[model samples]
Target: MTRGNQREKAREKNLKKQQQNKKGNKNDGLSNLQRKEKDAEIMRQKQAAAAAKKK
Candidate 1:
């Protein structure tokens, strides 16, 4: 009986965590293409900075 209660509690905790993850995107509702473009731009900036540091 105690084991069953623990299992139920663990299941509920997992479900709550999943729900929080689903809501945690920080993209400001950008579409897929826009998000990709933004990420690419950031990567380019980082690469440029690294090259400058190496020089």
Candidate 2:
């Protein structure tokens, strides 16, 4: 019975760690995507300004 209980505890600990890691990855990915989108928007704005200046 002790061994079984120990195994269950270990499994739960590992599962929790895995879930935390996945959450971290998802958060990182979302932030990177947002940064890229903002950068693209800035580039587009700069290009438009340049075109306006040329005309």
Candidate 3:
């Protein structure tokens, strides 16, 4: 009886962890795209500043 209880507790913990990991993976994928866009924006700003200095 105690063994069965332990197994049930372990299973519940693992299931919750799996759910959190899935959500984290989805969020990570979105953050990556945002990071790329931010980098590109920064590069464009630098180029604009350089061009203004040249003018």
Candidate 4:
């Protein structure tokens, strides 16, 4: 029983480590160009909405 508990704990620890590694590479999920294009598109939409509201 104790050995089973230890294995479970180790598995949980390994899962947590993997999740942390994935979290740390958040920026790598998008290419630089893609990220910039996404940001620009978001900004463009926001500005257009604001302009429409002003009119």
Candidate 5:
């Protein structure tokens, strides 16, 4: 009886974690393409700064 209770608790916890992960991913402000574009812009700025320093 105790073992069954533990298994039920574990199953509920696992379900909660899965739901949280699904909601967390959806809350991200940027879509995949926007994220990639922002990253590329940041990289370009860093490269420009390095080039300026070298000159």
Candidate 6:
């Protein structure tokens, strides 16, 4: 029906938007392992800062 067509169009629009947003991401080209390593390094730096503050 007409309602079903509208729902399908909306779903397609949302998928396109999501794909566009993904293209704009900062880690667009990085591999999963590299991302994890970068995140872990950031966490370590934050932990060291917190420890220094507590001392």
Best by lDDT: 1
lDDT of 6 by residue, 1-55 (tens): 9999999999999999999998889786899999999999999999999999999
Candidate 4 — which residues are off by over 4 angstroms? Answer: 1-28
Q: Give the clashing pairs for model 5.
A: none
| Full-model lDDT for every candidate | 0.96, 0.88, 0.88, 0.92, 0.91, 0.95
lDDT of 1: 0.96
CA-only RMSD, every prediction:
1.4, 9.1, 7.1, 4.7, 3.5, 2.7
Q: Estimate the TM-score for candidate 5.
A: 0.55
Better of 5 and 6 by TM-score: 6
For 1-55, candidate 2 gives per-residue lDDT tens digits of 8999999999999999999988876345457779788878999999999999999
Enumerate residue pairs that collide in model 4: none
Winning model by TM-score? 1
The residue-by-residue lDDT of candidate 4 on 1-55, one tens digit each, is 8999999999999999999998887456799999899889999999999999999
lDDT of 1 by residue, 1-55 (tens): 9999999999999999999998998788999999999999999999999999999
- The TM-score measured for candidate 4 stands at 0.51
- How many backbone clashes are present in model 6? 0
Q: TM-score: which is higher, 4 or 5? A: 5
The weakest ten consecutive residues by lDDT in model 4 span: 21-30
Q: Would you list the clashing residue pairs of candidate 3?
A: none
The residue pairs in collision within model 2 are none
| Candidate 2 RMSD to the correct structure | 9.1
